[model samples]
Target chain A: MIDKEQVHRVAHLARLELQPEEETQFEGQLNSILEYFEQLSELNTEDVAPTTRAIDVSNITRIDQLKSSPNREEILDCAPEREGDFFRVPKIMGEG
Target chain B: MVSIRDLHQQLINKDRSAIEIAQEALQRTKELEPKLRSFLRLTEEHALAQAKQVDAKISAGEDIGLLAGIPIGIKDNMCTQGIPTTCGSKILENFIPPFESTVTGRLAESGAVMVGKTNLDEFAMGSSTENSAYQVTANPWDLDRVPGGSSGGSAAAVAGGQCVVSLGSDTGGSIRQPAGLCGVVGLKPTYGLVSRYGLVAYASSLDQIGPFSRSVEDTAILLGAIAGYDPQDSTSLKVDVPDYTQYLKPDLKGVKVGVITETFGEGLDDEVKGVVETAIAQLKELGAEIQEISCPRFRYGLPTYYIIAPSEASANLARYDGVKYGFRKPDSNNLINMYTQTRAEGFGAEVKRRIMIGTYALSAGYYDAYYLKAQKVRTLIKQDFEAAFESVDVLVCPTSPTTAFKAGEKTDDPLSMYLSDLMTIPVNLAGLPGLSLPCGFDQKGLPIGLQIIGNVLREDQVLHTAYAYEQATQWHEKQPSL
Candidate 1:
């Protein structure tokens, strides 16, 4: 049974800011879903290996060579804020 | 409402110009747009330009591709170069992709004209397009009902005669469910059978791009254009791409069909079950050997998908912070605050809910109980398919539990909406190819789909079986009044 505090904690972890009413609503929704998920406890998967991917292909490496993109300006243009050639963001560190 | 083959023949015979065909499709789309709300953005200029190129090739006496001049809708989740690929979210509402997706890129290379970017549930999250931040795409058969989603617009466009065919990505039944509800042919190819490069990631392990069309033959033609290994997408399967159209035979002789016993009872609507059962009987009459096969772990697919998809989605969508492309909330004091506010303001409710669910499942003290357990259960489900296929060539079931429901019917209950994909989700878990085609209509005149699922990489068999059944039925011949 997840509570509003836990819902808020989950929302925070997901980098989402939920309103007070949304937290309460999600508390009910999440609990019902989680409770429904509890039905999986019936299956005994004690020795079963987890299937991360449906197909088994691995080590897909490409040659590490430097190649310049033709659309560098177009790529940079998609950024919300840019400083010349780089993406601009909020300050990460306090003023010394 | 012509098939791709007929349109292709018309172009070759010079009976219709590519520009004229494109114009007719665009004009029809405009007429249906007010009622269906199927497309997020119509690429009229780009479509006309592509049609002109095809016409130039025709005038030069060069052989054109099968898809040349065929108008098609693309689900906005795929990145189309220079086109706004919104994925039905406010976050990407203005985000124009700089590169093309592998599938759409291949489609364009085949000379298929891009009609527009169709709407979908935000980040392809919900079972219905109600979760779309832009607009809910209405079911073409009935105006008040929803076209099942998150590929609702793609399916609706094909059914409403807005486009001859379209492309949609399926993760947990997005393509098949909407195709079922909209009365069109939709296929979700085996995972890794189609490349995922430039497709905005939802659940990497489960996502697959496929075609939506009015006929199985058209679907086969579309599938052949896009299925192959690409150096860009490492997960793509390295196998010979067969000309899928060759496998479309009129008879199902020597085919062994399995009717999944678990899918018929309980929550399934009686009319849907009856329609699918009749379709199976028709398959048997077409000389298929029918057997009742039990995939016991089938019902567990929903909960397992909820855990696996959201966990991966939480990781995939983490890239949507305010610093990069897409919507950014202004005036944040710190880096973390910006990410929180941007995501909070930019994403719709269902997307946020899924992210939260995924975060909780993968968080500390809960990972072992939720995510790991779900993966282990997923192994059991895959084994169920493996064991069933040893005795059967293909599996048959209802694509969705019910026909299309009213637009706002399942909006308040997320779990109820999730149930819409119950029959289709397990196929994604096992990475199998599944195709949905119209079998019959319910008493309400809503369409019911018969799902034909094939073993991994056995798309030829799935198409063959669907083709046989489709040829024997008149359901595919009927189109919506719109």
Candidate 2:
């Protein structure tokens, strides 16, 4: 069974900061779900190929062409923080 | 609610103007909104405007489509230009999509009026609409019970006669489960049968857009309008769109129906089972050759879906990092902190739990044992369907194990909630077309659903069978008195 440390690690990887109570709640929840998933091991699929999609349509490509979007202003307007035409982000470079 | 064909007839025959119909729909929606809480945002002005356009065409002796001026609800997961397309999440609370999803685009082209955006489980994650950050949509049948979700609002809208028809996205039983609970007809068209372009992705492989209506004919009409090839979605099938209504014959003569034995076993509610069994008997009466087919790997759908859907969701939802559109938590000094805090603050508990589960499954050392293993089992599940279809034209089962449960019934126990989609998930996993139509009602007067699953791209067979059963039964004619 996974503990709080492992839950925290997974939460961090998913880019989610869990509250103390949420971490504890998820620990029990995840372990129960994972335990249910253990039933899959009963089937021997050594030679089985994994199915990624219901339909197998492969290598779908379109002609490379430049087409300007008509809603550029509307798209940029959806950003939470924008600087003129670009989206603004928090600092990436840390202080030395 | 009237059928789309009848509404179109009313418009063309000048018995009722499109504006009048739209107003009536909107008025009904307004009246029911307090009790049902189905819609997130109603586009009353836009719907009336679209209806006026259809009215103009009729006055000028111009041809109009079947869906012309029919008020419809859209699950907010699909992008709607200039509309707040929240996936029922706080993250996208203010995100107005600048574009239209292919399905909605097609519906607009067919002259369907956009009445509103419906609520859903946040990011289409939960079985019950309780996960919606906005509101928990109540079942129209029983105001205290949950309209099964994440397409609860869409199903409720259609079933409650708030709209003639509505669209929903099903990753795993999102459309069908709610359709069952709300006593509406819902279809999850074959994956790739309906284009996924502009749908807010939850699980890329599993997510599909479908219709919810009060009758099989309306479902077929809406499916015909939306099902086709599109260059925008690469996964869309490059196939001809058939007139799905042509297959809706009143007889299921010589049709092979398979009763999935695995679905009948443990945990299924006795009332639901009895109702489904009666529906199956009705199918036999319609000249269908019924046989019991065992898909041994069927029950594994829950675990397999939990892994695959979340794993893909983890990747698809990564785009929500504070850099792009959507809610971004402020006051973060660093980029990483911005992302973590944004997600933590924006997402609900269920969404966060899924993200964590997916992260762990796809993370280092667990990929082979979890995600890869689930995918392999998914193949076995597919093969089981393929084998069954070799002998049967369609498979039959209960759409949901039980009818609509009271809200907050399974909220605390996520596993119990996951069991709600047990029978329906395998259909999504196999990429098959599945539909749920009202079969009967339980002791509590809540509706039970009969699921009809078809082979890949064989929606014709599924619709035909459902049409036959629907014609014979009076279940679809009953609506809840609000």
TM-score of 2: 0.99
Worst lDDT run of 10 residues, candidate 1 chain B, spans: B330-339
True contacts kept of each: 0.83, 0.84
User: What TM-score does prediction 1 earn?
Assistant: 0.99
User: lDDT of each model, Cα atoms only?
Assistant: 0.94, 0.94
Interface RMSD per candidate (angstroms): 2.1, 1.6
Looking at candidate 2, what is the lDDT of residue B273?
96
CA deviation > 4 Å runs, candidate 1: A94-96
In model 2, state the lDDT of residue B165. Answer: 92
Task: Provide the global lDDT of candidate 1 against the true structure.
Answer: 0.94
Cα lDDT tens digits for candidate 1, B1-482 = 69888999999999999999999999999999999999999999999999999999999999999999999999999999999999999999889899999988898888999999999999999888999999989999999999999999999999999999999999999999999999999999999888999999999999999999999999999988999999899899888899999999999989999999999989999999988999999999999999999999999999999999999999999999967699999988778888899999999998988898999999999999999999999999999999999999999999999999998999999999999999999999999999999999999899999999999999999999999999999999998897
Residue lDDT tens for model 2, B1-482: 68888888888899999999999999999999999999999999889889999999999999999999999999999999888899999999999899999988998888899999999999999988999999989899999999999999999999899999999999999999999999999999999999999999999999999999999999999999999999999899999999999999998889999999999999999999999999999999999999999999999999999999999988888899877699999989888889999999999988888888899999999999999999999999999999999999999999999899999889999999999999999999999999999999999999999999999999999999999999998999999999
Deviation of model 1 at B440, angstroms: 0.1
